[model samples]
Target: MEFLLYKVHGSMNTFFMLEGEEREDYEEMTLKLAALDPGIDGLLVVLPSQVADAKMRVINRDGSEASMCGNGLRCVARYVCERDGVEEAVIETMKASLHVKKEQPQGDGIAMYAVEISPVSFQMADLPMAYGGETEWKLKPLPFVSEEIPFTAVAVPNPHLIGIVPDEYQSNPAHQQKWAEFFNGPNEYFTDGVNVSYATKVEGGIFVKTFERGVGFTNACGTAMTASALVSCLAGLVPYGEVAVYNPGGMVKCSVEKNGSSFRLRLTGNATYLAKQQFKWEGTSSESGLELAEELQEQALYEKFIEQTSAVTNRFVS
Candidate 1:
């Protein structure tokens, strides 16, 4: 069977989008394709949704399914927009049905999209974290950390444990290495594994690095960034407004909303289309491999988008 592979990236976290109804062995195929060279963080299977414009199934490289992926959602929004000739779309994820709107281009070629992330919660039962009988959960230092580093658990429909560290620590390679180790290591509180993000306040907003649960150190984590912004606001680091979130890959803007004790977030960033190619699907099993019929030709465009976005981000924040 012929399949179109659209390689897209949002804030440097890349994913492959496959349109059409999934084949019986699509999960295995997704795993194989995501494991390809240069690597991909996950696969997005776009299928028709009765409740929305389109339904997205997020499959990580390890073949595990995720409830939601903010970066992936942006890419899917752009894809559906271009294919359907529409400016907005409602995408139904595993957890929530989200509203995505196409925004003005970042520059000449870059496409910008904003997605509404909601149903925010901080309950330990929602993160499904193991906790003793506690009425409410708040930010506290992890038991494993040597120093007193406080962490807040927030679920933007995706579980994230956020720790705000010093800005200098974010730039240190050793600190990043150690942080990743701790995230992946065994922990009593998070038995099911949770996405971990370390944030540091910057002039404009916050800089974050994420060690994702299924996917390790990615260039960026959209929900993690949102979670960081929320935590920063709660900790009195930044106010509830437009917050500039920078990751190793690039920068995205997050708008935080707080009403009484509830919160909501909107993420705006580039939904960059990198390449499109035709591939031949041979079988329906895990061992079934895909044969690439063509090469990816949009490397220059991808690089240009990265350069231009980074420049804009640096000039604004620096």
Candidate 2:
């Protein structure tokens, strides 16, 4: 019944952190909390060291579980570091090890945190894509989606299909949604599962819209960001090594290097801290958005809570 909630604002997105309860089924809690706080776009769970056997889960606000999330980990790492006062910490997720470190605080009250996502995989066993068994394939024109597209298929702890879109389509919401539907819709091609991305190059970096599996189109996605950067580089869209990924949620830094036949992706960013409180629900529950907002407002003390806690500032290149 008891839970600890932490909130973090990252480069391009926001995350809700959950911890403290040993018996709480986090997978279920993610959905419960998302219903309770619809404003939250993503959720991260940190299992106690005592219960190391339990796998950590990251759930999108829509109640879909992602195999891995790059931006979410940075935010979660920042939350953990701020609370534990440790410069470096290791937080385990559903798939890989998230090594996080807190740097010096900036003047704007923003503290930078670095997170290293394990690596990338292209083995048919690793990416598990039904297509040819992962022989270093780039996203080429595909008739399946009925689009002649240049894409990159990589396994950066998760399977993703990253495609570059024209500048015109990049800014169009309807076009983005159409692609999202194609990747997530009922189809025999990506039966096991796949996330699709439409990326466009801009002045500073690349802007991407991702239709993720388990979760639909979310504000930001880490693995998608990594795949975008890699695909961009391989297709000569961008330089290799470090790249900027702009998603609806926020911006994330992606770094990649050739590893044998595939590549490795490392994402780095920040997570913010939000207010924490206890919730007492009575009577039948309603799934209406208005009801959830009302419940959250009751727990929010506003001015009083702000006075008690120091605000965590967010800084972006924009």
Candidate 3:
């Protein structure tokens, strides 16, 4: 069968989109494809949604499936919008149905899209944590990573454990090493494990680095950024409003608002299409063959995206 391969990036977290049938070996395919690109965070399978305009299945590099991915949704939004010639669409994910709209373009061929991420909760049960009483868990230190570092657990329909650290530690190699250990280490606190974020307050907003569950370290984590902003507001560091979030990948704007006892979030960022290629599926097993066409790389478009992002941010990218 014929499949269109698109390398899409949202806030620097790259994902390979395979637009085709829902095969039984998708898990295997995801593992294979993700292994081919060290920069790739995961693989996204695009399928027709029964409840919304389109359905996206997020498969991590480890062959595990994520309930939802904010960044992936934005990229899929762009894909569907361009295909359907529409500005708005509702995408069905494993956890919730998300509404996405194409906003003003960020750069040449770089479109900005905003997605509504909702059904926010802070209860320990929602995060599926083993500890915690009736009160929401916030600013509590866990032994898994560090006894001194306090963490807030929140689920923006996707479990995240956010830790607000000093500005110096935001990009510190030692802290990044600890983050990597905590997520990959054998920890009892986060029974099923959680996406971990270390955030630091910056001049305009906050900068965050994330070690995602099943994906290890990524250039950026959209949901983690949103969760970090929410934690920032709750901690009184920032007001409940639009917060600019910068990561190693790039920048994204998040709007965090409190409604009643809960909070709602909206994420706005670039949905950049880097390249498109053709892949041929051979068989149905894990060992099944898949061949990529020789002309798979779209270097021009990829370079343009990198150049535009660099120019707009004026941030040096190695």
Candidate 4:
């Protein structure tokens, strides 16, 4: 049967979003759909949820399911809210049920949304990163990388290893990629792998690049950027309020507040829809052929909007 789907992005971390229920082969199918031209970071499977507006399942290109994906969550939030005719809704993710609300458009044809990324924890047991049996991993020199560069681990429900690095290393893709791959691949620190990011403070805000766990070197990883914002604040890299985060794909404004012991993060960015299509999903990934239905041109407007943002000049490669 033919099924409708969307090509969506938040800060250029693209995904193919489709409505579906629980399935056994979703991982395999994600690998197929994410391989489309101008490849996607992953596939977002929006499912019916009894507890919330919708359930968002993020399947990475390598066929691994993520506990949480903030970028994918924003796209799914827009899709379900528009479908069900709601302005605000709570999305059920693997780790937490998140609140999402539509916002004033960032630009012409560019829809904006803000979603909560939380249940934040600094405890090493939460991320389960092995580091000298420490309870919390924060601003400590990890000898593997460099003593000069200190790393912090945060689980915004997605384990992220954020290292506050020098501007030269942050701008160096090779340097970041090497460390990310090492940690993600049978390493001593992160056995199950980790979403690795190298961030550096810049005028106005911070510039971040992430090498995602299942997907390597994405233009952006929403949870990673959110974690970076929080860690930057904890490390006194930036003031503990609103900060603009620039990535290779685009920019998002993040704010972290101390909510008792744990923290709370809110991510606001463009949830731009690029195109819509229909595909025959006859149960197998190989047989499902995608047919382009319409181009929304939201991507063009998003690009224009990013160009207008203040931090665009500080943007660099991932």
Residue range 1-318, candidate 4, lDDT tens digits: 776878889999998888987889888777667665547888899998889888999989888989998888889888888998998999999988999999888767579889999778888888879878788888888886788988999899999999998778865678888888888888677878999998888888888889999999888899999999999998898987788998888889888887567687999888888889996766654677789669987777888877765354454652
lDDT of 2: 0.62
**Model 2 C-alpha lDDT per residue in residues 150-250, reported as the tens digit of each score:** 76667777777777777656555575567557656676445557777888776556777777776666666777877788778777777888887666555
Query: Rank by lDDT, descending?
Result: 4, 1, 3, 2
State residue 294's C-alpha deviation in candidate 2, in Å: 15
TM-score list, all predictions: 0.88, 0.78, 0.87, 0.95
Better of 1 and 2 by TM-score: 1
In model 3, the Cα lDDT at residue 10 comes to: 89
lDDT of 1 by residue, 1-318 (tens): 778888888987988888989567667777668655347888888999999999999887777787888888999999898889999999999888999999988755578899988779888778766656653456687565535667887778888888888755565546555655665568566666688788887777777888887888888888898888889888888999988888878888898988898887999988887777665666644444455535454445556656744643453233
lDDT of 4 at 35: 60
Please report, as a residue range, the 10-residue window in candidate 2 with the lowest summed lDDT.
309-318
lDDT score, candidate 1, position 310: 66
- Pairwise TM-score winner, candidates 1 and 3: 1
Runs with alpha carbons beyond 4 Å of true place in candidate 3: 132-135, 183-185, 283-318
The TM-score obtained by model 2 is 0.78
**TM-score of candidate 1 to 2 decimals:** 0.88
Candidate 3 residue pairs in clash (backbone atoms < 3 Å): none
For every model in order, what is the number of clashing pairs? 0, 13, 0, 0
- Looking at candidate 3, the ten consecutive residues that score lowest on lDDT are 309-318
